[model samples]
Target: MTLSIDNLQQMEIEYIKMFSEVSEDEQTLTFNNSNIPDMYTHNFDLYKSDVGLLEYIESQINKVETKAKGFFRIETYHPISADLIEKLSVKPQICTYDFMGIETRNYINLIGNPECSVLSAESSRVLEDGITVDIAVNEEGMGLDFATRRIKGKAEVYKNPDKAIELFVCYSGDTPIGNIEYIPFNRVAKFEDFDILEDYQRRSFGTSVLKHLLEKAFDNNIEHAYLITDQADTAKEMYKKNGFEKVGEKTELLFLF
Candidate 1:
């Protein structure tokens, strides 16, 4: 059985909320990074309908083990009986164990706040950089209202706010052009880590702003930072220039039965 994108998205949303709830007690449980994009489950029936979802989970668990650090183990919880299984024992894949699986997915890389040097010379050299931007942290209702118009002309993705800190940025003229939506991760213990997005990409505006943000993160006592980028994106080099190392990977898997 194949799941529609809408159904997949809905499942993801539910899982995000579930992870958020889990984070309330244990701050380490979040679903925004690498292979576990946002697989939330409000209705187990949806997953049950798909015979191969369990295999997908198993593959993801193995993949995560190879690519990420900090988590000791992954488990699946059955809501009704409060039963937890360390490894999904079901075999949804019909084939024999004759081949290995490889895939990729969209995810955000997280890092603890850490101090690092980013070349401010690039932003200063860009004569097109003319806007004065100011970022406001966690003042959602009003700040978003003030920043929405600026964001209208740009790109954005919202992380799970409950497990992470929320940020809102505005310009001096009440026009916001860029934003960084992120969560608090303690793994990269020396860096105040975040994912940055800008409405405009030409002038190194977003990169410049991110440099400042990292500076602030360092001031707050952070050491390392990480972010997940599409394999096609060249900006990975920028992250490297700023002192982040590629510590893990996430792949997407599609299941059809």
Candidate 2:
């Protein structure tokens, strides 16, 4: 019992249709039943016609969710039919959509760019939820320490106070209005190099921090840089300005977590 390419294609379409009804999110479409493997593929004509990929995706998600043994995944070009994308009921596990990229050579060029030069412009080195911040870095050379620890996977346990990093912003004060922490990545691709407090968003701060991070990666001899964000958001456009193009789409990998 073997399936031809055409048979597989048809099965793919059929599976897509079935998943759409149950999942309501076409992005979760996957061939594997136990888990949605993270696969990155792209089609430029996804939005050439009215109700083209969106319709197909919706139909497929419905089919998969109805028979979900685990999870589902899908990726497409930006500007997916907003109305259709809203219908998806899939619980977004981890969204790695808005990815930015720059040539290894241009790493230095981006350093002086206005987007990365502003004094007020800061990096999202830490992310927080009101009182409890998941991460932090200090002015007395603590951020680099935490970053090194995080990348080395030794700072996983933050229960010890010394393990934290003390981060700062443009504003000058004894206590920061908002705290920043060092969120280091194993690979220097995705999440804008770091995360910051939710309060200090939309000021174009992350752009600057990312530039600094790029410089650091370059110093470390990294040739290429990248990051990912929600596929259907303004972040995609933001990355475009930063010189990142869609290389491919990665389907959800259920068992990784």
Which candidate's lDDT is highest?
2
Query: Candidate 2's residue-wise lDDT over 177-230, tens digit each?
Result: 332223222223222224434554455555555566556556766555555456
Count the clashes in each prediction.
27, 38
Candidate 1, RMSD to the unseen true structure: 15.9
| Candidate 2 TM-score over all chains jointly | 0.38
TM-score for all predictions? 0.38, 0.38
Model 1 C-alpha lDDT per residue in residues 97-160, reported as the tens digit of each score:
1111111110123232232222221132211111123223222533654444332212112223
Candidate 2 lDDT trough over 10 residues, lowest sum: 37-46
Which 10 consecutive positions of candidate 1 have the poorest summed lDDT?
97-106
Q: C-alpha displacement of 119 in model 1, angstroms?
A: 21
Angstrom error at residue 160, model 2 = 13
lDDT, residue 174, candidate 2: 25
